[model samples]
Target chain A: MRAVIAEDLALLRDGLARILRAHDIDVAAAVGDPVALAAALEEQQPDIAIVDVRMPPTFTNEGLVAAIEARARRPGMPVLVLSQYVEQLYARELLLSGAEGVGYLLKDRVSEVGMFVDTVRKVAGGGTVLDPDVVTGMLTHHGRNQAMARLTRREREVLGFMAEGRSNAAIAGKMVVTAKAVDKHINSIFMKLDLPLDADDNRRVLAVLRYLQTD
Target chain B: MAREDADRAALRDVNWRMILRLEASISVGIGLLMLIIWALAGARHFWPAWVWFGLAIPLALQVAIRRGLRAPKGHRLLAAHGAITCVLASILLAIWLLAGARHAFWPVWPILGLGVVLVGHAWVRHALPTAREQALADRVEVLTRTRRGALDVQAAELQRIERDLHDGAQARLVSVAMNLGLAEELLSKDPQSLTELLAEARSSTLTALADLRTVMRGIQPPVLADRGLEGAIRALALDLAVPVTVGGEIPGRVPVPVESAAYFTVCECLANVVKHSGALQARVDVGYRGGVLSVAVRDDGVGGASLAAGSGLRGVARRLEVFDGTMTLTSPAGGPTVVTMEVPCELSSPRT
Candidate 1:
């Protein structure tokens, strides 16, 4: 898989490229600045581009602009954006651009190598990935929906884990319970919210996210 | 200046006219007195021929008067000469009148004294010290204001440095210390194996490193130096909870001092809006016109703001002053406080 990387900091860009290359992923080109990356995008076509949310010449939203430009030029290209903080406005902007094959995740997610790689693969394969924290932050503060208001605290925790794309076994380990009990909690949450019982991680995450994200 | 000089010259011409009128009147009176003397004692040798020599006094007075009028701002000398001539001329006229026809020549004595008073009062009242004193006072005031503005700017810069250090580096160091303390406790307990404890120590080290870098960035924002004002401000807005509508654009790179002041002003303004204001939105506009860079931050929040000592407004005012700039705040009691800060790019450095 061919990918382009745009990050303002040299160390972070080099580190991310090394980690991706170690997983046998081809980094077609890596740029430490946004302007050069934009020019490169015009010349070279990459299947996927991983961008940092802030980059130079102005460290503000160069990454967001780069993502928009790439999507505009090649609508089929998959882009994953990394940010230090979970910002609702940025998430809204990304989701509003037709959510297929787009990903927004915290930079710290790279610590979980397996899940991070899986997310990259999913995004490249035409799936949408949203950071569970971003969804949680947005829903917790501003959500006024009745179904969300009725969720028990334990059910909310389960929902959070689900949104993080966690398997039942992992949720069980974190909750210190049997996987059978975790399964029951997940089923109870799905029933209370009246969502389809899809077993796929992406679809399950999307359904829960779409419900919680509703106003 | 030319107009004023012309006005003075016109006044001088008027004074000359007055003196000429006095001399002409006196000349006609003296000629009348001579005719009366000749009529009383026919042109024979009753009076000595040398007595006619006293007539030279009036001619001499006219020469002195004309000379005084020629020089600019020399009214004192000119007026003195005219007054003396008028007094001497008056005494002669009085003696001649008493000796011959005895007309009331003493009336002209009062007119002579009036001229002296007029010249002396004009010099003392409006022409001399008022103009010089005013110029001196103005110079002193301008110097004082410039000095005060310079001092205020420097003091504000120092205050900002203190604030950044206290909030950023100091706070991070405290957290680092706490993290290290916890890691040490875990090491001493050995509840986990040596490997796990080492990992904990490693994690603390990484946390400290990250915190320190954050502190460094907060101090200066290295990206601003590398990129420009636009990039730095956008980065700041991206993290705000409320909507930040950026209006207008800044062209090219500004000098570091200008950029730093503008950057911090925006930062402080945004922080106050988020923390204090119940407003849902903010607007920031930046533009350049006629060599001045203008920055304005407005919020639709409760707007009772004061620059009472120790307020952030005071600090901002001082900061702008350093760049030969000013900060004006228009905040009423209920809503909408607009802070406008303007600074000239190429002004003489403020001197204390």
Candidate 2:
């Protein structure tokens, strides 16, 4: 897959580009600052865009804005956002646009090269992959909600993995449970959340996120 | 200024001494002349005694007035009044005795009038403050309050830093150390788990670094040192989700303590803009004029922001209070929010 990277730090930007290249992913353009990121996204039209939450000219959330704008210009355009810190508020804002083909992770996750590469490829393939930290934050925030209060302990655990864009098999592997048990847990979670019983994993993930996003 | 004041006081003292010496010499010369006149005119009826008493009374009154004038300002008026009244009363009583002790006691009336005047003079002296004194009192009150607030904020900040470090990086490092020890114990026996343990240790180390960085940033941002307030704020503006237009010139650097307080205040306001205000754009204007550094952050967002909400803005306000700074928030219900903060400070020359 072809990707474009937007990171202000030269070290991190080169590091990301090098990592992706080693993973056999082509980095079409790697640029610093939001203005250049916007131009590169427009010109390259790469399969995915990896962005930092902070970049020039204002280092606050320009990268997040650029990614949202990129997706707005091209709906479902895959984008992975990385930051030193992951705020639930920023995650909510990012998901508000659309959950599909989006990934928000902390920069620390890049140390896990295998997982980082997998997440990038997953996002490029139009999957929703949120950082576990972001998922944990969301769960803590919404834990007391009426719908969330109805979830069993095991079901809540399953729901967290689901929110992190894990497949049933992957969730089963992590939980050390059989695939059938993981499937049953997911079905129960969907029912408790009052979501439709969607069979597609990606759609199911979106549905679960939509339910979580509600007040 | 001290040297000039000392010189002026010395000159006044010399003048007072010269005047006293001249008065003394003149009185002696007059006394000698009177005695000579009495000795030459056939000594009888002792009328020269009256002349001597009259001259002594005026000299005594002059000395009293001069001394009263030299007294400190608050007591000067009262002292002068008392001195004049005493001299006048004594002179009147002497005249009464010299006039063969009047039976009606007429001196009491004049004495009563002098007492009333002196009382009024004392009242006036204590009742009002001079402009300089009033200003000084006001400045002392402000300094006392701000100094206490500064100390309180500083104490609280240090406590928070300690708590954060203890719970965050320090705890993480302990975990990392434990993981390393475990890996060492399982080095050969469970080589399979050794890699996992090492990875966990490395991850904890990274987390500790992140924690340390956050704490360091809270204490003092490196960017703030590299760029002064204006430049640092400009850098901050670049990081926001909405485009922020930074205007005005600061000319030079504000004192570091005040600058940090102001910068954090601006950061808090901007954070509110991002979280609470659904504004499309924001702007920061900074300027220094009339010895006050002014910063105003305005957002075209949903308003209704208030300090009473117990938001972080209240903490920011308290922090600014330590520097004798002020914050004003104007956020109407419909749209547009403006936060203006001003600190009285002087800017130093820009660092080369």
Candidate 3:
């Protein structure tokens, strides 16, 4: 998959480009700041864009805003947002465009090269991914926390992995349980959270997240 | 400023003196005319004395007004009182002398009344703070409190940062060092054991990095540094568990120290809302107007939050006090708690 990377830090930007190129994923453009990122997006039209939360000029949420604007121009333009810190609010905002083809993770996740590459591929292939920290943050303080509390421990575990855009089989492998059992736990979570059951994984993740945010 | 006012007052005095001289000339001419008329009609009874007293009334009032204006600022009212009292006493003396001082000294009663009122005015002026001194005293009181508060906040911040580093990053680095040493020893013997030890070391270093990041954030958040107070607040609002609607704007960046203090104050308020309020939603409003930067955090929660109730908010208050800032909280027992903090400030250029 072809990709574009936008990060202000030179060290991190080069590292990202090198990683994607090593993974046989073509990195068509790597730039700093939203202005350059915008120009690159227009020219390259990469399969995915990896963005940092803070970028110049006015190094605030410029890159995050750029990613959203890019998606607005072309719906479901797969983008993965990275930040030094994880925030449920930024995650919710990124997912607002379309949970599918979106991922929000901490910048530290780049160190786990295999997992990072897999996330980029999953996002480019139209799957939603959120950091486990964001999910934990959601489960602890959101208005939906009470609903999360009603979930059984095993079912909540399944829900967490599911929100991270893992398939039932991937979740089963992580839990060392059967795939069918993982599916059952997911179903139980949906029912307990009072969400409509869905066949698509991204929609199921979105439904859980829609309720996971503040009511 | 005082010199200019005095010069203007002197010019006014000269004008008044010129008018007084003309009036005095006119009065003496009238009195002399009356004297001549009395002599022509066989002088008797001396009724011109009453006419002179009537003329003195207007002159006395103008003199009293000028005395009030000429007195120093704090003493103006008392000067006016004394001048009016003297005028009344002089009138009483004139009445006594004109009425043939053989009576029971009735002028003493009216003169004594005027003296008593003037003395009372002087006593009150001495006892209470006059306008200028009172304002100075108030300013001194504020400066003293805020200076002490700034020192206290500085000391407390230093202590907290030291403790966090000692327990978090320092401890993790120690573990990582030990793990790396063990990995080095195992490298010559068992590759499997060495690999596990190396992985553990890497994990420990990552944890240490996370710890350092947290401490850095506490000291100065990256977003706050990038965005200034207005945008920093919006970023903070987004992170809270409760849905917070952020409103208002600032024209330019706040100074770094003030920006950090305001950001932490809002952070503490939000943390309280999440922990104590159990409310479904919250609101944060930030605006700068008329040289005052104000931030109000409102939560729809069970209230009863007070500064005396928790050290967290009190610390926030102290932190703000250093900047000559103030916080007011209104949280009645049932719902809708609002905490508003204001700081007098000037907007700095966007970046230094």
Q: What order do you get sorting by TM-score, best first?
A: 3, 2, 1
Against the true structure, what is each candidate's TM-score? 0.53, 0.55, 0.77
- Candidate 1 lDDT over residue span B94-150, tens digit each: 556546646655656666676777667666755666666888898787667756865
Which structure is stronger by TM-score: 1 or 3? 3
DockQ of each: 0.07, 0.04, 0.23
Each model's lDDT comes to: 0.70, 0.84, 0.84
Pick by DockQ: 1 or 3, better one = 3
Candidate whose DockQ is highest: 3
Clashing pairs in 1: A58-B231, A60-B235
Clashes of 1: 2
Lowest summed lDDT window (length 10), candidate 3 chain B? B231-240
Residue clash pairs of candidate 3: none
How well does candidate 1 match the true structure, expressed as C-alpha RMSD? 10.8
Better of 1 and 3 by lDDT: 3
- Candidate 2 per-residue C-alpha lDDT over A132-166 given as tens digits, one digit per residue, 9 for 90 to 100: 97777556544435787787888888878877878
lDDT of 1: 0.70
